[model samples]
Target: TLLEGVEEKIEDITNKLYVVLAALIKGNRANCSNFAQSARLNWLVNRLQSQQASSGALEVLHSVLVDSPEVLNMITEAHILAIIGLLDRNGRDPKVLDVLCSLCVNNGVAVRANQNLICENILQRRDLLLQTALVDHVTW
Candidate 1:
């Protein structure tokens, strides 16, 4: 099957998944959350941790996490770890920051991961990124 083949391929799986998930999420939110808890999603999160995530994948991930906060409850620790790492890597990316900030403000997995992300990633590098003169002077 095409879905099974996508699982086997490594080259463009993340990008392919971005399209698949975007469509799935819109078709049925509950099923999408179930899919998010699957091993395939675990693989996707692992890719994000390795910095292999595409912009589309990250955008869909943010949308899923923010739009369906209940999904956070179903996500595994591995997912949390990957999300934390992804957030750290893209702290300066506003899309990532926006989703992460919303997650931190909400309950469940995000609430638990919030302290760690802030203390270890965002806060640790505050002056270098968030509070820098460049951020204040430049737009975007």
Candidate 2:
């Protein structure tokens, strides 16, 4: 059966799906966070970290979170902070900085309005990013 075939090839299917989903997210063609998360992006990140595929995985995650213009209003403050923290820790990657800037400029208002406490909690982090020499290279 077609479903059986798909199930049997879950890993291949998921990898292909990730490619498509990553493209969509990078192109800003999808606005649904649920769809993005459904792709197991976080799981992919963990897998990448485990396998030392950090660069590729971070690239996909950055595209989904930053390049995707679809602002996920439902994302929790903690979640946003977590992404920021990850970027801060591994932000030496150029792509990570790009995504961080987008979140700061594009999603900043919604984040501040919805989760003032969380926003405040990460103020130092934000400020540090701003102070970084790389900050100038990130536009919007």
Once fitted onto the true fold, the runs of candidate 1 whose alpha carbons sit more than 4 angstroms away are: 1-17, 36-40, 51-53, 74-81, 87-91, 107-120, 131-140
Per-residue CA lDDT of model 2 for 1-140, tens digit only, reads 99978765765565566566566666554543543553464564454444322455555666665644454443445445655555556644565555445555554544345345445655756754455454547567
Please provide, for model 1 over 1-140, each residue's C-alpha lDDT reduced to its tens digit, 9 standing for 90 to 100: 99867755753765776767766675466755654556656665655666544555666666667666665565565565555565556656665565456557554343756556455755555653555343447556
Name model 2 segments beyond 4 Å from true.
1-25, 28-53, 66-71, 107-140
| Alpha-carbon TM-score of each model against the true structure | 0.57, 0.46
Among all windows of 10 consecutive residues in model 1, the one with the lowest summed lDDT is 127-136
Model 2, residue 89: C-alpha shift (Å):
3.0
Cα lDDT for residue 79, model 1? 60
Pairs clashing in candidate 2?
Answer: none
What is the model-wide C-alpha lDDT for candidate 2?
Answer: 0.53
Against the reference, the lDDT scores of all candidates come to: 0.60, 0.53
